[model samples]
Target: GGAKYLFPGIAGPDIINFTHWLGALVTSMHTIGVKDTPTRRVIHRAADFLPIPLLCIAMVLKGHDLHGLYIGPHSEAFSAAADLSAQLNIITVDRPFNHVLSMPSTMYDDLWTAAKAMYKTEPAIADGGEVIIFAPHITEVSYTHGRLIDQVGYHVKDYFLKQWDRFKDIPGSILAHSTHVKGSGTYDLATNTETPRIQVTLATSIPAERCRRINLGYLDYRDINPQTWQGREQEGILVVPHAGEILYRAKNLSNTATKGPHRSISGGASTS
Candidate 1:
């Protein structure tokens, strides 16, 4: 007298990618009012590289109740394909699943190195000055706000100008963009040997003109090395060995878009 069809929703790509034939047999069992469906596997580690394959293998190894699987933000396998397939089913589904990564190792190491290097030199951003950080956009996509802070480091905050005022400030006061600057180096020209001048070169993914247009500097990635930092001229420059690993937060000049002072993982890539 009520509804003729009994539908169940699958959360994450796990159901679509791992389950065979929509687990139709199990769903059918539930449709007939079967009260109990066994769970084949329970996934706890959402951070693993590919969690869906693991879920699929477990489901096939020891059948499960298609209706019993519960999914949430922690289920990391959600994707476009999974979402599309869900449209075909009329069942009331569970809410979507998602999660966040703590931080990439490359970023941690780079930040630590930069912090130590800058301690003696102490790079500063004056009251009206700015410090720009350029990286591939994909790099920012991989970081959460908290992880970004770890990559940016706490000590750097001491250098921010307290009375800063600007119409437009990059996120966190640091610009994270698609441009790439891997390394930098300096060349010396000893003309007449009086006061030798140094010429610096930057290796990057984009051309020098683009960097100039955006008011950012450039350096070739390969030019920088261990010995380069030892030079006196290099003292003030903070080198981030790997942009993909580091996440940075720039200081905000305005209060309207102020984030939490605690510096939590406020933003990052979203999981389906």
Candidate 2:
């Protein structure tokens, strides 16, 4: 039994809001829960958007013993849902994001920096594999952290005083969320960009008989309940982690606003 804190940015007003369900004291309710029911699907779609992951957490908490179909970038939310679901019977698939991407093709500089930091500094994702999982060249990169790791969850709070563009743009596009158990609170980043909400559904449902037409190499399904998947129709997708490290060079770049080594980020959205 754990608590989930959904941020206001990602939580849309559908039927649940992050403040409502996640905000409520656990002492009050225990059944299938929703942090924000009336979630505005508009901000729900962004891939890096965090609120949707909260939804996934809510789902697993309520339906830990269910057969679900999931997809998208797996982060703290994904890990939480998967663990909580506890083999409740779920299948996840991978697909290109259905919404406007935060990480655009034009963001080469930002992407390069994030890729380097992820491979170099972040031990959680870089340990077992090469420190730089992507590429030393940095034209493109991708990686997944199979192990549980910990990173400080400073979010908007730990930002250096100076608002330099170099350190942020990339990690901003991709999610910097941690799957570590200690990461439960919110830390605001510099921007309050809107995201999208896309419900996960099977993009393609072809049976093994059609294997000749398809290459089942990418499919990775982890069964929760052996009873449900036995001779039954079920599928899972493979979602890897897109982890990165935050560059605090801005503080040194401009010290006027940069207070001290500890006083790095400022003017970030307030998160209590």
Candidate 3:
């Protein structure tokens, strides 16, 4: 119909949501410019793209499903947001350099402690080894997928190679992306067979299948606390909390004393 052609074209829910939000942003920008008839019409049209944001507001007003807390007052909302930020591995921390891994959660501490107890601690991770950072589905999307690298203040050597080839090529280090799977296993994808690996699980709810498929070595979130690192483990694997936010490097931390001023290591990785 002719009426359909008068407005933006939307394919589905996802597209509509993004377009609507974007439209709102564009409309906001329009407020700073001239307000003509066509501009007004565009602004009016963009106003309709508020379903998702409205839904989010409603959810927050009622209380988040994950925690079931309705922050009524503005101050309370700010407090809640701060607490939420910390939980998401985003927060303001004022501290000096230190060797101890100030892990965010008990789950992370247990896992790292166990791995350290089991594995032969390496003087420098760059000597040779792999680190597999894993998290739950939500965390994977929010933090682990790729955002965690920025929060940790490390630059990817080759952005194009990593994006196109799916390999994080940090110098003297084998950084691997974690995949969500039903079972557990490690796959040797490299030509060389002597790469060390670390498996860090971020509070996953998957069954312990052990490293069966891809042999990067395996560490289960469940296996921590209850069980210490089994016998003698190979390499060093650490499952950090807020996997998207924290990428621990021995050299970086060990040399933090000589480094520049510290910055707060918190915030969500921008998907953009």
Candidate 4:
């Protein structure tokens, strides 16, 4: 649920903070399942802060005979979904790569959706690494939020945190989008310097000048060929085809390996 609906009439930083808290609460529910006293307590506390009517409706629906609830820390369908997610979304790499070529599909028509390429690939990248988002079709940073994004540019979370007064007027969601694309890093208060953990480059229709202005590196899409990047994982260069949907992680950090039969790719080989 969106903040506008869940936290109706509320605006600015407080709502954003509450939304973040709600997300964390929901994620915690996933670990222990939702059909328990702890989950009910959390929801009850949240209801006090939110509209009581919505909670009343939810409570009424909980006992509805038409509804089929899968309250689970474990269930057959849940296990199957988990297994499928591992096969499709989780790609395990032997080590972090210095360079990654992320290829977004046609669904990513603009930078807003295309940003997933960075999100999905960040965990597999080494410090000071570069992720080249290769999408010839993407010509705008964000169709809905381009002007706001242009004014802010992309930066680490600390950039906004250390200098909150300068950016406090901007919407929290836009600030979040800016930081996520920039990836993790540090910002120095004394020197007013920001250093991102990874360099995000664009190989797209968006111009080099605009890319630079937005604090992103640009490469002419025509100059590169996807074929050259294929089958070169050993060189610390990764090519992820259909990039945005899958998540790439270093093997050491992954809790569960991908199981069952699957076809092999250059950087991601299925782990038993």
Candidate 5:
């Protein structure tokens, strides 16, 4: 919970499972007794918070019935989930500067590939009763959703407005306060908030917090005809399913948006 970012709240053998630092903490305790009880009590405090953390994991994951793995820039949520491992279907990944969609597209592909390889769960089954809902932070999606602004779907501007409102309501949001487990990289509610309209660092430059709103809007407004949440096409059914679903979806969507606008001249004639 402190600088280590591991589950220090939990005491006993469980702490050993937290991180390398925790194993050391336990080792230290065995070899040398510390004066402060806070050091020892952290593990139990974590143990006590188990049920609440589990409830949170359930709520965050309830959007999709499948295995919900939260790839975070930090591991607070996962550590919290670790306590109630029996009740939760979740995994966490923490990489510095890796706040959701900030990573490259290749990284996302690699991540999905690795996850698929490891879990080996069919996209249909892993998706639970409904589609799998994988919600990343959405930084890049904000800048890119504008290209799809005029397409036959919701306007990017209006989409962002709704997204801002909804983000305040998500499970672990400060406004919602509904989740027992806390989200990592949260900003202080009192300060460090700014509107893109107010403080102009650059054209359309918004703070990370507000930027999140735009990204959320992108997700809400996307033309999913070409994309997969967990996996597969929503409109097209595959002969073999999942394996060819993405390619199948690509065929149905307007390729112009993905590749580039068509470049045929009005007076073009066949020239040898």
Candidate 6:
């Protein structure tokens, strides 16, 4: 909905430094009453023009205008659907939990979609807590970017930011993917220590050795039974079924533990 998409979308993963930095700069400018800058115009035009050539070719081949083809006939229906989606996915929790069992569905067949479990569950996890990606079917880190991910591994954003030169050669998308799965944390250059805000454990088909190499914890998927995790929110435990689709946020933004009644979704449940 905003300029954030311009970073990786139109800017592309290559030339990531300039694209990312510029995208942020443009967004800041828009926020500070400087909306009509030359740079912003250029980027907007570029974004608009990017697909025109291909779109034109398609229009010529098909001999039809594509205008209004994508928009639904009923705007009210679309708005109502959007509202329902938000209600279902953007859930608010009363407090952070100590342990979160994030169960990515079959749609998340690879680490690419499975990684979303961490992003979606991060807001509901306490500091020093653990989030287990419980997907026995997900055996690959990424079907397309597995090799690169294996090389750099998953780490907090600062781990790469503080040591930019060492990782500058890698693709930004890959680095972004790494951090998204790792969640948030800090890296101490002097101590050479990486302290993630929460521990991310992969209880998937991926091996323990590989998980260790990638700086993530590992547990055998067979050891976990989803039914056992149900109704345990009072004990600071959370079970999120079809985890990747929902965004869970604690009402207490401090990420601290609080006592409250728990809420249960149809398939997933959490402490509200």
Which parts of model 6 have CA positions greater than 4 angstroms off?
Answer: 1-85, 255-272
Superposed model 4: Cα runs more than 4 Å off = 1-88, 252-272
Please give, for residues 1-272, the per-residue lDDT of candidate 1 as tens digits.
Answer: 00001011224434322232222223222211121232122222223333353322111111122322223333322332233323322222122101111112233333222221111111121122112222222122223333443333221111222212521132432311111111111112233121101111212343455334432334433333433333232222333333222222123212121111121111211110
Candidate 5 lDDT, tens digit per residue, 1-272?
22123353333333543332332223221211122234335544554554544322221232235444443322354444333432442222121110011111223232122112111111111111111112232223223233332221211122222345644332111111110001011222356331111000001112334333322111221222222222322422212212211111111211110111221111121110
lDDT of 2 by residue, 145-240 (tens): 211111222122123113335333323222232111111122235574211111111111222222112111111112122233233112211112
Tally clashes: model 5.
Answer: 7
What is the Cα-based TM-score of model 6? 0.70
Number of the top TM-score candidate: 6
Candidates arranged by TM-score, highest first: 6, 4, 3, 1, 2, 5
Q: Give the poorly placed runs of model 2, Cα more than 4 Å off.
A: 1-67, 70-130, 136-159, 162-272
Clashes of each: 13, 38, 13, 0, 7, 1
What is candidate 5's TM-score against the reference? 0.18
Full-model lDDT, candidate 3 = 0.27
- Cα lDDT of candidate 5 equals 0.23
After the best TM-score superposition of candidate 2, give how far the Cα of residue 248 lies from its true spot, in angstroms. 24
User: After superposition, which runs of candidate 5 have C-alpha atoms over 4 Å from their true positions?
Assistant: 1-88, 92-174, 178-222, 225-272
Against the hidden true structure, what lDDT does model 4 obtain?
Answer: 0.65
Model 3 segments more than 4 A misplaced: 1-68, 71-79, 82-213, 218-272
